[model samples]
Target chain A: MKIEGVVFKAGEVPKTLFKIVSGTVRETRNKTYHDLGHGDYVALLEYLLEEPIQENIVATEETEIIEVSLEDEYLNIIKRIIELRKVIFESSIDLEDIVLDDFNFEKVDIDKYLEQVESLLTLSAGDLPDDRDEALRVIESLDDDKIITKVNLVRSFIEKFPEEEEGARLLIETAAKVYIVLNDRYVAKSLLKKLLLHYSDIPKFCYEAIKTLEGIYRDEGNIIWRRYNKIAKILEVKLRGND
Target chain B: METIEFEPGQEIIKEGEEAQYIYMLKSGKIKVQLGLYEFVISDNNPEVFGLEALVGEKYTETCTTVENSKLICCNSSEFMEIYGKTEVSKKALESFMRRTAKVLGWI
Candidate 1:
């Protein structure tokens, strides 16, 4: 059967091995995570070691995975792969100077630390509500640059309080910045539409959303025109004369 | 291809509509209903639906808005043709089917 999947996310390490009968594999690794997609096999080392596995394997998109067991034949393949992997990892490591040093434990700065804690509490207590209000105020203020900062602040606040309507609104405004940034049009369009539905009465949000919708259509390439037109019709109805 | 926006409680694609397009959720949340089962796919987990239609098949379920939503629509035939040409797309489709089958205990 055919398979379709994307590397939605990765865990600390890979825990599965997939032998590609056919197709290609793409592996992406970033500071926070590592992703493996399609034809890549996972966990060859663990299978060879017969050790407890420590990584996660999740399909990036809808995927077809044939689970391979550690049978004798598969074990031989795993052994070869493990040796190759060891060689690769070892060759990549660089030797560095090591200094032998004695460890000393320092006395804790109890009072100073307490004072710092109090200072942090005071700062957060004062700044949180102010930041939240400023985020809302900036949305109302409609200054484009302020709107962007408000969006970031709103997202930060939402990370702490996802149910906040004000924060959600700020996210919508931030989403609109897609038109200005030219990155991830789909995400921007989605955010604008969400704002109109959730914050329809917010005044000017609907207008801004419609304007962004138009921008999406104008900017989309011809190959995507058919999809753009359908979205445009909806925006036309939603924005009406607001745009 | 067309785009559709739905408010919470709105139905974007009915259960039995001739699946003509592949849907990409650009934002918000959508709920897919199949008989008694329901799952919500949102911006954080945007979904591509009506893919079966790409194989010239009927839609397996109805997709509606769980919250306000934005959807990008692409002609099923066009999308299938484009997707068919890509090795990644084929692998993704196969992986998805196998996983789904495993989850449902069908394989």
Candidate 2:
């Protein structure tokens, strides 16, 4: 059927999905525009979840769409995953904008920034935020205790950088040290492993990772200790040759 | 093709270094480090690394071996003399295009 404007209002459950046979529709949520063109699915995620539609799907131009029912469970799952990824990825982009905006030399409210970092922790996979330089600046300016208090969030923040910059390395190393004190040795071990992966060429960080990782493994059972022991020994030999 | 072997954790190429050879993975795993992104090239892959040498550009990324590995190495003139007319040149160009597309998020 031909449609024009406000096809699906926000908060209204659009029980049916539409295949855009022609023209375009704009999906807006929280002031962001997600334009959909030919062959795009409208309200598919909302329909699949049977939840209130969170976005206003409006026909930006007089558009043609066919109401379609999704019956294949496998395809529905794939669609759900795609929609979820879009949500998470877009959230990262939005957070990057907010970080860039608030990141400045002026004194920052630590609690406000901590809330932002907590949200960033939820993003497991996506492009590194373009505002990472400012983000790192903000992270670096924080007190060690503040970072350690939220070490898991700090680790996730640093891991977003592909290469370990000086600031990032320092932050992750600090996180590794204090996470164990908080009884979160798992985060410590993972950060230590990340240090090894990115800084293998640098003996200083390599030795630190090997030392900390060994200490963490030592607290485990004999089998786990022995398993980590072999790798640590190999890295130690490599570090010695570089010295 | 002249073959060179790199031990695991060895730095085969450094970013900003002069591009010397087009490298083809012969065996084992190699990591290509670009900015904040990394991808692996393994044995039996038809792609080549260090294409910057062909254009006389500096190596854009550092390449390192993740395991003891062998690579087919060819300098610019050598590459032209060897894979110049063969299907390998086309494949190499295609690989470069695919990687460029990925970096641009076009695919």
Candidate 3:
């Protein structure tokens, strides 16, 4: 059915499951989390769960929804997911909006950010939110130049936060990943080599850096793997010598 | 193909998220599910999944790691290229026929 107006209210359940085929659906009742566009599900979960629809589904424009019915097997599966979602929400911080906002920092002060993260980690106990996950959430969030800028800050963060060493290591690893995802392997390679030499003293730092390098070069064939293997060999020897 | 590691409870694919890479389980088990139904532990099956967006398949299921897991992933185009190979195609066909023949009592 084509919808130019509201289909269901917050308290009512729809008779049939409808999937957005074209145009947008405004999901409001809580907060506007995000707009549901084409190929998005509507009322399927609520209907499957036999619960009242919790959101106001209104078409932002001319919207087409094809009525859909799942196989009994599939309907059973969706019911379990609704239950699982509640269980997950109870255990972890609601990460539903993690991908909604792209990590857009026009001015990123590395030190101030670390301080904020440190305080947050103190309260939450080691569950610091790393910006790398944000970058990975949306692959196009950071460009090559932006990632390079972040990598340069990794060393300084490590130096400043000896107590929060893991966060620093994560930053460096994330920076390298940005370059890898962008196919700027040269920058990623150089960053990994420098980490081996510069942060070789910290065992956890070296381990994470090497793993990030491995992940980045995982697509590269045997020859490149051998080259990366050589770097690891040297890093191990240097680290042992320092010990 | 590339190998990626995931921690327990990490959602590799969400219910409505665009399917990017087709994945093959290398090690460890993953729970694949939709709202109420969960597929059995995917330890025995070596089938590739997360291809619905590439093809025209509707996915209500989300796949999450059960433990520290390793998976090999390839883009749709890359997987198709390898899957389209004559040797791979022949082996797959033979495997299917063998299973069908056994079921039919013609083995």
Candidate closest to the true structure, highest lDDT: 2
Candidate of highest TM-score: 2
The whole-model C-alpha lDDT of candidate 1 against the native structure comes to 0.48
Instruction: Find the 10 residues in a row with the least total lDDT in model 1 chain A.
Output: A97-106
What DockQ do the predictions score, one after another?
Answer: 0.02, 0.02, 0.03
Provide the TM-score for each candidate, comma-separated.
Answer: 0.29, 0.33, 0.28
Tens digits of per-residue lDDT for model 1 on A80-174? 33333232222221123211110011143322433353454442222334455664554455455343344434445655555566654565557
| lDDT digits (tens) for residues B1-107 of candidate 2 | 58998899999888678888889887989888653347788886856777677766666667899999988998988887777646676456445544443442323
Better of 1 and 3 by DockQ: 3
CAPRI quality level assigned to candidate 1 from its DockQ score: incorrect
Tens digit of per-residue lDDT, candidate 3, span B1-107: 89899999998887666657767677778887643335534546554455443343343357899988888888767765776434433332233223222222222
Tens digit of per-residue lDDT, candidate 2, span A1-243: 999998898899877778888989887543334577787777654554455766678998999998865532223333333343333223222221223221111244443544455466553222334577765555556565454444544555555655646634664566465564555665556556556555656766666665666566555421233333444565578778877
lDDT of each: 0.48, 0.60, 0.52
Q: What's the true lDDT of residue A217 in model 1? A: 41
DockQ of 3: 0.03
